[model samples]
Target chain A: MLLSNLELVPGRRVVKHLGLVQGSTVRAKHVGKDLFAGLKNIIGGELKAYTELLKESREEAVERMVKQAESAGANAVLNIRFATSSITQGAAEILAYGTAVTLE
Target chain B: MDLILQNFDLLLFAVLFITGYVAGRWNERRHYASIRKREDEFAGILVFTNRFPPPSTTRVATVLVSGSAVISEDFFKGVVAGLYSFFGGRIRSYESLLDRARREAVLRMKEQARAQGAGMIINVKFQTFAIGGRRASSVKGVEMLAYGTALSPVGA
Candidate 1:
């Protein structure tokens, strides 16, 4: 399915608006990774592990969102947006939301 | 020798402080240099925050592109930020950290657009999170994510 974080896809016209669809997931860091991050705080640089973790979480969220859009019979998701919130000390929630629409 | 052994905690703090300062500065310099170089290389791909793509007669396909970067605060910057909080003044050290994270994220997004043969990206959005920062004191790092729609020519 085509995904665009814009009101209208460049060359595609929306024939139907299936309403809003959203997907979210809460993820917690592993204890081992948490300990590694603590040590990484000392020298201050890129945290590849954390980066990868967040990336995976976001992709999962987007995947779920796409599934929802597909179930709604939408050919594409438009005006997509993402949100991240720390739900607790070591956990965060990643959210993806957009308007599901059929394009022509 | 006796004094050093007696004040081992203080000695260790001193050693950590020096190492953090030195290494953090070096890393920041290198990162900025690389960012600048990449920025120059990717200058052809324009990025805009407007929600609408520019008018074009040629058919273009819009696709979602995104990039994220996670940067951790060094020991020295964290200490300095702590003191700055106490003083109620701007934390200059963290300014650079956030700057680097944002630029790096954008660069990654641009790289993806370039790979897809897109010359411009529009409707850009940014989301930032403080990882492990449930408490004010334990903000280990910041994560920056940039996302947008990339318009690539359908047939070239």
Candidate 2:
């Protein structure tokens, strides 16, 4: 399905508004990475652990959002957005939302 | 009698130490899992957006996170304890959630633009807010919002 951050897709036309669709998830990874990250802190470089962790979570969140949109029978999702929250010290939550719409 | 008392004290100390260690490790794992889940979800949604086009007209979208949605009791407690950590403790988690929500909202807008036969989205904006107050039995919610204008491509 087509997804965009803007109200409307630049090249397509919205024919109908299906409704609002969204997906969210919470995740946590092993703390060994955190310790490794701490050691890397001294070197002042990128934390590969966090980077991999972030990438994984992002994919999961999007999968959920797309599923929601698909359930709504929307050919496209408009005005898509993402959000994150830490329910705890090491855990994080990611949310994706958009307006499900049919395009012509 | 003195030896017996010392033994009892040692046993108590061991139990307490074990409990603390387990609790600490559990808490850390919980946090890591939540973070990873969120990150994966966000990345998946972005891939969809990148494959799509931007919007052409103004539109708004929002996503929300509620306390009831959290399953981990310890994580919930951590949120409560976080209040005392000068808000930094839980801020990272909240930020990640909000970021994912915002990105998804933008993607939705782009979808709208494509539907409208627009070329690009313009004037995008985001907003966030707390909808519920802290309560022992109540769930708090955070909302993520995005808005923008969809543009049509030239000579299309």
Model 1, CA-based lDDT: 0.90
lDDT of 1 at B125: 94
Q: After superposition, how far is residue B18 of candidate 2 from its true place, in Å?
A: 36
Per-model TM-score versus the true fold? 0.95, 0.44
* lDDT of each residue in A8-82, candidate 2, tens digit only: 554457899988888888877576765654333222222445545544675687778889889888888877777
Please, what are the lDDT tens digits per residue for candidate 1 over residues B8-98? 9999988878888998999899999999999999999999999887675378878899999999998899889988989898999999999
**lDDT per residue as tens, model 2, B3-100:** 87879977765665455345534644554565566545434232222323433323433222111111112233334345746645455544544444
| Candidate with best lDDT | 1
Task: Give each candidate's fraction of reference contacts reproduced.
Answer: 0.82, 0.03
Q: Which one is best on TM-score?
A: 1
User: Candidates' interface RMSDs, in order?
Assistant: 1.2, 13.6
In candidate 1, the residue pairs with backbone N, CA or C atoms under 3 Å apart (3 or more residues apart, or in different chains) clash, namely none
